[model samples]
Target: MISTRIWNALPGPALVRLLILLIVVAAVVLVLFEYVFPWISEYLALQETTVEET
Candidate 1:
């Protein structure tokens, strides 16, 4: 029953290509949020703040 059903299912190469694309996109997004964006934000905030008499 299972083998017959799989014979009628979608192709394997398409599924593999889709999974690889998803993995690459996820890795790039994670690196952007985890390392690049936070460092940029911290640098900008430090530049904005000043020691003033109040």
Candidate 2:
């Protein structure tokens, strides 16, 4: 696949390539949790309501 090809093209030895891949994955996860999650939470936030006694 394209990703495999891209991965093969990366510089450095196997261990270094693995480290770079891990770092990239970690960065993506961090970005999603820190920025994307908060942005999504704003739109999906739950609404609070009070019940009136009759």
Steric overlap count per candidate: 0, 0
Q: Which ten residues in a row have the lowest lDDT in candidate 1?
A: 3-12
lDDT of 2 by residue, 1-54 (tens): 998996898789999989998999999999999999889878874555567999
Whole-model Cα lDDT of every candidate shown, in order: 0.75, 0.88
lDDT of 1 by residue, 1-54 (tens): 985564446346767756766777899999999999988997676657678998
Query: Candidate 2: misplaced stretches above 4 Å?
Result: 46-54
TM-score, every prediction: 0.56, 0.74
Query: Measured by TM-score, how close is model 2 to the native structure?
Result: 0.74
Residue 40 in candidate 2, Cα distance off native in Å:
0.8
The residue pairs found clashing in candidate 2 are none
Worst 10 residues of 2 by lDDT: 42-51
